[model samples]
Target: MPLITLQNVDYSIGGPLLLDNVELSIEPGERIALIGRNGAGKSTLLKLLSGDLRPDDGEVRVEGGVRVSRLEQEVPHGAEGDVFDVVAAGMGELGTWLAEYHHLSHAEHVDTDKLAAVQARIEAANGWSADQRVVETLTRLDLDGEQDFTGLSGGMKRRVLLARALVSAPDVLLLDEPTNHLDIEAIDWLEGFLKAWPGALVFITHDRRFLRALATRIVEIDRGQVTSWPGDWANYERRREERLNAEAQENARFDKLLAQEEVWIRQGIKARRVRDEGRVRRLKAMRVERAQRREQQGNVRMAVALGESSGKKVVEAREVSFDYGGKPMLKALDVTIMRGDRIGLIGPNGSGKTTLIKVLLGELAPTSGEVRLGTNLQVAYFDQYRATLREDWNALENVAEGRDFVEINGKRKHAIGYLQDFLFTPERARAPITRLSGGERNRLLLAKLFAQPSNLLVMDEPTNDLDVETLELLEELLGEYEGTLLLVSHDRDFLDNVVTSTLVMEGDGRVGEYVGGYSDWLRQAGPGQVIAGGGRGAAGVRNAAGVAQDTSSTASGGTGNAAAAAPQATAATAGNASAAPKRKLSYKDARELELLPARIEQLEATLEALAGEMNEPAFYQRDAAAIAAHGSRLGETQQALDAAYARWAELDG
Candidate 1:
């Protein structure tokens, strides 16, 4: 009855068994999220489901003729051709013929004879439906069919492969970290697209937001066992906590009993009696059980090393412009980045996030305009490329920098000791980085970066490949970091948690600064678009009290508060306005404006109270109906406050 089933499966590479007596099943129409700590065999389980790997023991069964497709974490090397050909290749032999036909038909040098022959083969094989599906998938993913696949960015290549997997129309789709290289826009789109898809989804991801949005069922791999958790992400968290606590208590009881048995068995005279022979056998079995037990993995102990304070102003830009490939990447940007400001940069892939970071940090010169950095700034940068790491060195060598010890916050710690805090054993720490997993590499990079203190921290796409626990720990670290942070991440939850303000690359080299993080930007800028440079809306990034609440750097000509600015400008240009004979406010209108401030304050207090209640963990545990009602009320109250702000601005102007 299941789409795929694994029964009493045992698998391992060399040492310890990666999976032991694992039993799991995939049902049609289920969105099962496979989650675990790094090296817990999540990907290995996916391969077993896809029939890419055979279990050493037990049976894996699939319903007759059900197709399975996979999107791997790493892009396959040497993938070639335009997007269409690569995607169509997912359909096997029929796909090959259709792809050949497509390339021949679209070539600059027309190959009519070859095209016709390939077309005849495709028709004979009845592959036209697969052909249409390929085109449709490309369009859905916003991939250009004629574009060269090898030339695409890593993020784009991932998308193309995803398209290829989707074009197969498999009943089961296994995606490993599907959100890995995608930008926020692509992530949002993928969430929506996957929700609309009809096939069963078994995905492994570290994106909490994406998991919360798409997972209909939760499955986790711990030790060597696969488990299915009931309910949503919130429910899973609560349930998992309960399970772990119970396991700990049970293990304690078992150990206590085992200790008593050992003491009894040590008696010199009574232990050898014939009457105690059964007791001796039972004790021997208990020893085997204890030896076979697997302990829980230790958590990553993360801490940030902060540097001395810098000048109040961190970096300031005036009419900054950058151009590459004869096109403007940044244009006329004015921003004053002050100390301790946590800023998030969001844009599509190839939208110049890295370049903008470089230009602002004075690492790369802008094609036009000026940037000034504050004095005494100790900057620590986390490159998304991990370029700072020498591939030739292992974790210890990389973090040590030719010394056995590293100083953290004026305290010296051995390099191996520090790596241990990140969950690396001495063996792993000394092993070449090429043998480490993606998550391990990310952890190593963090270890390297945090070894030294810095007044300014710049991280680009720092959330990729990290386990959920490690990711959350890093977020907690960044939250407490006493320094300016420039974070470039597509992770919605991470951005929301770490950044107080955002600078969005809207388009055409224009950057828009708004108060708050990704969700705030969404509420202000709508779903797919961003606020244009220097533009302020009535409710753009509004906080409690219906006032614009953003501490981000303002671009040139941008106004933070139009309501406050209108009155000041009016008084400053009184002479010019006198000749114009400005229209006067009616008595009723003036009275309304006078009362608006108090009304706005009341609404703000109500909004704050509601938000505070919802922010608590227990609030989300409430019934769905109650939570939905509160959310609806909050939205209504926000709308009313925004309307009041708009009215006040109109009267003042």
Candidate 2:
């Protein structure tokens, strides 16, 4: 059954359409992902669906008596009750009724009127004991115990709220950025819960993995129009690519048509001196058609520019340790960031990725270590919120407020003009900062940041609210940036596509360095099968005879000429004694290292193919299995790469 329907809904603020003529009907058991760039009215639509707001020119109807609940991004943790009570409130009317029924059961309620009223209330609310529901929900959400939820951290508080919403068992669950504060373990728990959920769900989130894990359908809001895609996030991405390609083809065809029209217009005007009224009329008609064709929207382009800088180590930390309110976050960390290095600072959420960045920026002092900065380093920091602009200030004023710029080429251009290059139009330039969407504010801040010629950039969660297009632009900018970058983000695509190396802060407050992207780091440091005897037993390794093997061959005496003496081949492959013959890997061992690249390419292709299928509607019901398979395959490929890398390192290092 359709739980809710929006008929020609049009929402506006300050006379500008926020959502235009959006017609959508959501039924029970639909797990929908509401996706858009920041400021595309995704949250606004959720508000309207939740009955907290009304559309100016449309009707929103709820089917039957279906209830809706929204789990807000910023949860209120008042100084009132314990976390248990707070989460129990998600049960709404059922909870209230359960509490009243309990009171009636405990009291001496012999009065017939009181009994009838209590029974009526329970029946009206569908008569489920909220206490039992709360317990069940809390357990499923991993918030069952008092130890976990009562005296909690910020990350744990987020989990409690999510548990509360699930406990309510509403017809529709509306979640806004629910994964923002959760750690890896909690996120995994939530993912499993959502996978098994039986009700309708509409969630807006920045966690790509979470969205890919749970969303069965995707609804994208662009400009003011909502378009629905029938599969998961990856499917939406594929369809978006198809649409863009089609648009590009259509645009090319339109341009050719316009060129023909232009030639006709020129000739018609030239002949107008001797032509009749019909010729002029025909030219005008062609002109109108050309104008209509030219009405196609232009692509949004963003370019980031960085000034030249001396090639030097911009920031270095030696034995650095940090603590917050006496709890150690980062300990004995040694790191060096050089110019032009694109470094990813990754960890489970709350594992001090941000804290480490803050330490480097000198915003937070290290408890016990030295942080050295290059003499000529000019660092620009992008905060997580990127909401530093004043609410009342326009874009131009916001950009130029405290910065000083000199005239160039005898022309004085305000900071606003510079912003126009980043796609902030004249009308949007004067709009108040508060009216801008999250993505807009991020762009505005980025524009302001790049306008300054900073050599070292420290970005904290830079990809948080950015759309895929904007993120790609940022990736291109970072790729071409001449300065150093230290970015902290949970976005896997961002880390894998943008960064070259990673600095991971582990759960034990220790930091480690890895030579590649996030997935690479995860394979090397995360729990995986590591071959003994220096990558010898690892998968994908081969012997000289073209047999598939691992680095463990050297230890197991497997890499040898089948006719040659096993003891002799083992000794040759193992020791490097000064008096002994220079030990060499037999044909098999040598071939194993040589085949690493081909194996890596094969794994990459496998991952891509599996990712494509993971988004198919056929796999939505098997999301858990699909995710597990993908994760397993990813882990395997990463491990194989690691083993190959280790073998290569031994030879090259």
Candidate 3:
């Protein structure tokens, strides 16, 4: 039996159909990733699964006695409670029993039997350590247990809500954008937690790393229909591309056939004839089928035009330091930002990333030192708070404020036309900013920021609330960008895909630059080492005698090229090795190796056929559960093929 099932579900708001005839069945221990474009009903589907909303048609069913928990994007408003209390709320019945025991124990006449029953219930629920678990969850999410929830920052509140959802250890967990406000450490922790969770999990997240690490299956909602693929984000992307291509080919074939039928119908045989009337009916049916197939092939378009370039040295900071209330936020930091440098700023939350950006932009003066900007440096900043937008103004007004027109490629384009380039229709352009979804607002902000031609771009948490499509589009645009970029984002995949180097901000106000992506930074930092003011000594510097040398510096001010300046060992330091002769494979092993390539080729062909079948609109529109089973078989075949290749390589080597 499935843990949760949705059969022919239809959901709508106002008039437009958000979900139509969607069928899904989540089995036990399945990790499902729900993904779609913004406002495509991914969250609405999650809500339906959690019973927060009922389907307008069909049925949503959960197995008897199963518990479902959901973590929504919005934090509960007007809840005047501490973080601990809120998180403990997830305990449900056990929490009620615990509270009742406390109340009864304080009564003048102690009810011994009632207390014993409550204690027994707690033991049965396995909630004896519930308090400790709540505390631990809160700590991992970076929320103080004693802090008032209402007073917490938006990010902190989000953490608290996540903690509440996780503390209960429910049978089914549904999370919507769980990593929206998390830092690198917290996101890593949450990834591990979700991976180890022993239950059915469904979540909506744009973080590619998270999706790759935790999702065993991918469910996409496109054009009011649901299609599921069995695998992580990387596999889903490859398969989706293949599916789209196959669909295009199928459409082309249909078009060709329909054109021939149209030609036959135009021959003008009398409709009164039986054969001629039958041909007309068949032609009409073909036209309907062609239209349906075309609707399944919708596409999203994105293009970004990078601005002009600046001087070689775009920004330079000389021994910069910042202090707030006698506590240092940034130590003596000497950094040179060259043109075409894509730098990713990283650290724990509240580690002075924003402060450094402010200092660079000269919005705030450092306690000591100076920042210099190179010639013709036009910097465009994307603040995480969207502070530049006015809530009362419409989207067009917000984007076009203070300008009748904006220049693009040395040509003046009207504000409405510029807005259309960002996918905002005339109707949406006239909508108030406050009514826009988080993603729409983010897109509007991007449109406004990118409208001006700037040689340098500085963005803070730019990936928040963006769909996977937008993230991919942004990554492509940034890769093609000719100018310099400085970005602060917790999305590790984004950092790896977009940035050339990473700047680590230690919580103690020290900063260090490493030449590589986030994974490279982790490799150099090693186990249990915080990224602080240190050299790449652990990255392995060797002396003339072949001994590892420490080329570290104690000073806070250090350039990014620390590893480049380290001395190389001489040829004499190279160690001699005994050359072992290669051994031939045994008869059985040789025979198996000979057959492996054939088996691999056969599996590849099978996978290709399965992909083609999955791409067919009829296959998806017919039975989603059967298609998912086929996907699973496809994944299994792929794994087997990989193992066979590995064995063949081992024997051949």
Candidate 4:
């Protein structure tokens, strides 16, 4: 039986219908990927299914007693609580009791009467088991129960919401843009978790990698209608193209017939008399049908204006190091960016990709290094915060900057007309900036950023809410761009498409520059070899020779010949291995000996975890860098375990 079904659904907001005569059903254990344009009512449809919104005209049927849960695209405002309380809210009245009990228990001055009442309610409802479920979910998602919900990072907050949704144990789940702010590591973990989820899933996402990984079927909403494409993404793309072409051909034929009929009727009185009555009536119907035809929305016409050519060396840094709050953000980095080179900056969040960009741009002075910028460099920065945009102004004013026209590639164009090229309607272009959605804000920013020519383009986390079509157009534009690009995006596919090489942060000021995109970096790094984001093995991982390898070495073939200056790790260091001898045991050493057995057990456990991670089916499916990072972590863990065992034996003997 279908978990949920919609029949003859007709829904509309004040204007045109968002959904008209739509029929759909969700089966058990199906992972459905919903797709559409930015304003195509994807989220609206999810709301209808989750019973958050009722269709103006239609019947939405669900299996009896089936529970539906949805994770909203935007986190709710004015939400206050600890992680446990927020997650527990998913459990209904029992959850309220649990949350109250937890709060009272943690208060500085406990109210005994209130605490006991809440505890009694929990006992009556057998809510302890439900509480345990919340804890397990939190742990699985790496959430701290006692942490303040508002104080967590964006990714962590989203994870908490997902945990809350999961704790409900709903029969059907709907997720809207679940990967918006997640880093690559968090995204990988989410993909793995959702793959094993038992309930039916219908999610809307702009992340192509996530869609391709978990979607069993693709469902698209367009022009007030719904269509389903069975099979994988590749299959959907091919068939969708064919369908669009055929639709165009049929529309063309109908229009041609309609035009001939109009010509016959428009002739003189004698010709009108000769025309058949039935044909005249048909022509009238054709005119109405033609007027009612809903044409496809226009694609975003995106293009970047190229400034004058820059010097060959765009940016150069020698032994650059940056420290923040007594911690090294970037250390001993030597890298050069040449013109026409597109470099990707990737790393775990807070691993210092932004810090590196700042240092290179001369926004922040490196602790000790010579920084040089090439001459005649016009730099355009697309900040993730949309800092370049003015909150008080509308789209046109933002781009126009009090001028009626803006020049693009030496051509003067009216600001409103230029905005139209990005698919913004005249009215929408003039609307307040706050009225725009996240995607709209992005488009507006792009329109403003690309208005002026620049030799160097730096975009940070730019793919946040863009639809797939827009993202593709942006990628196409970037491919043809003739400038140096330093892009920092969490979108793997975006990185693969636009970046020529990658600079990955491996914690502690270590940045490894690798050839190719994300997957390419993986392939080059191999298993356990390089940590793309200082998740593990940040200092350096050991190879078979027990020598720490330097992952930050530049691979040969960068435009600037960077490999020559970078030091590459070699087997030459194997001969330098030495261990300090232990001759005596002081009181401190005696205490250490007493704790060494348990420490060995801890090392063994770490090795087991490393092995388990590598054993997963999805482990090998990731790019080579991910596999290699884990492989290196595994190798390091095993080495530690071995050393611990040896030390234990030596002391015992």
**Mind sharing the TM-score for model 1?**
0.83
Task: Sort the candidates on lDDT, descending order.
Answer: 1, 4, 3, 2
Candidate 1 lDDT over residue span 82-181, tens digit each: 8888888788888788888887777789888888888888888787988899889989888998999999888889899999898988999999999998
lDDT (Cα, tens digit) per residue for candidate 2, span 230-294 = 96555576688788789779877866866765565567556657655775676577667655442
Highest lDDT: which candidate? 1
> Which parts of model 1 are misplaced by more than 4 Å?
108-113, 267-275, 526-609, 612-653
Q: What is the TM-score of each candidate against the true structure?
A: 0.83, 0.68, 0.74, 0.82
**What does candidate 4's lDDT look like per residue over 1-653, in tens digits?**
99999999999987789999999999999999999999889999999998989999989999998999899888878656899988998887888888888889989999999999889889988889998888888888888899999998788889999988899889998999999888877776677788789999999999887787778899999899999988766567768888999999999999999888878888999886677998878888999999999999889987788899999999999999998999988889999999999899987677788899999999999999888999999999998889889999999999999999988888898888999998899999999999998889999999999997899999998898899999989987887889999999888778867888999887667888887776556535533444545355422222210110122111101111111111122112222222334456778767777998788668666755654453343553565445546656655655565566555545543
Looking at candidate 2, what is the lDDT of residue 373? 78
Error of 1 at 539 (Å): 12
- Candidate 3 lDDT over 546-642, as tens digits, reads 1101111011001122122111111111221113344678899889878977886787677556644633435534333454466466556655655
Error of 4 at 479 (Å): 1.0
Q: List the residue pairs that clash in candidate 2.
A: 535-551, 536-550, 536-551, 536-552, 537-551, 537-552, 543-588, 544-587, 544-588
- All candidates' lDDT scores? 0.81, 0.66, 0.73, 0.80
- lDDT, candidate 3, equals 0.73
